[model samples]
Target: NLGDALAAETGFKIEMIPLPMKRMGPELISGNISFICYTLEAWLPSVKEQVLWSDVIFNNQNLLVSLGAKPITSLKDLDKKRVGVVVNFYYPNLEDSFNKYQIFRENGPNNESNLQKLLHGRVDYVVLSSLEYQYQKKLQPRLNAYDLGIDTFGVKCAVSKKSPLSVSKINQAIAAMKKSGKLDRIFRLP
Candidate 1:
């Protein structure tokens, strides 16, 4: 819906392609897909030259969550526990931090799988974006979240290295939308 709104507002028709987030890296690198709409942090420096970040669509903060248990308050609290994490660039920070105290186990594919693991006691806790966690909590009221004082980041649409046309157009459209408040209106829509 947000992609459609951006297309409408900018007069640039964006092809909304849906793929599992886990496969996005390989697909984008192999040119199977030309663009990805995800958090800016997902862009690895190795692939950075192939992509351009545009338009801050959402603020994503990683959160530690568990099922109705006392919220995990510190890195020390994670010791010897299995932590579910999504695969990709975001895991490096978590891996480095959590490995210091615990045996970290990654639950891959997507958030649904990770959440299911937490629900079924396959893992002690999971790391996810706050927005995603909130949405999931609506589906599973038994879950609880904790903030670990990490800086929140922006989500952006990334264009492939070969698609200079798309990148240029998208950046221009995003700048125009930002100036005109169109982006704000789109996000505010119910």
Candidate 2:
């Protein structure tokens, strides 16, 4: 949908690629992909010099989820508790706590696996992106989510510096999408 919007807004061809969450940045940096949409600036640390980032496409959050019966009301409640987190994903709010042994991290392949770990008592809580949590919450009514505050992101698009697309063009496309309600249709965002 964003590809369609961008093509329409910018009068240029837009090719969308599906890559693993972790692979998108590297692919963009490696020039294998021209651009990736609806991503976090934090996700493209090394690409700061290699990509032209659009204005925020949207805002998103990462949440800490636990079973309803054993709710974690606050981040401090996670102290000394095992947290199920995705492998290689950054948890800015928990890094120091994990390094200081304040919380224990149990790595999983993805958010779904981490949620399963939480459900099975393998971990006290699981960290998941808002989209994943909302979708999973629909299927598992026994789950609850908590905001860790700093887990929010200004989601944007990154175009490789080599790409013909410019930040201004991409930003205009995003603005057009928001004006037309295309973004809401795509993400059903807050």
- Local accuracy of candidate 1 as per-residue lDDT tens digits, 41-146: 4545556555566767656778888998776778677778888876654554566665465658675677788888998899888887777776787789988888
User: Among all windows of ten consecutive residues in candidate 1, which has the lowest summed lDDT?
Assistant: 41-50
Model 2 C-alpha lDDT per residue in residues 1-190, reported as the tens digit of each score: 6678778888988776667777877787777877888676676666666678888888788888889745656668778899898777777888889899899989998788888888888998888788778888899998888876738888888887767777787888888888999888877776
lDDT of 2: 0.80
Error of model 1, residue 158, in angstroms: 1.2
| Candidates' RMSD to native | 3.3, 2.3
Which 10 consecutive residues of model 2 have the lowest summed lDDT? Answer: 68-77
TM-score of each candidate structure, all chains considered together: 0.78, 0.85
The reply for model 2, stretches above 4 Å from the true place, is 1-16, 20-23
Each model's lDDT: 0.70, 0.80
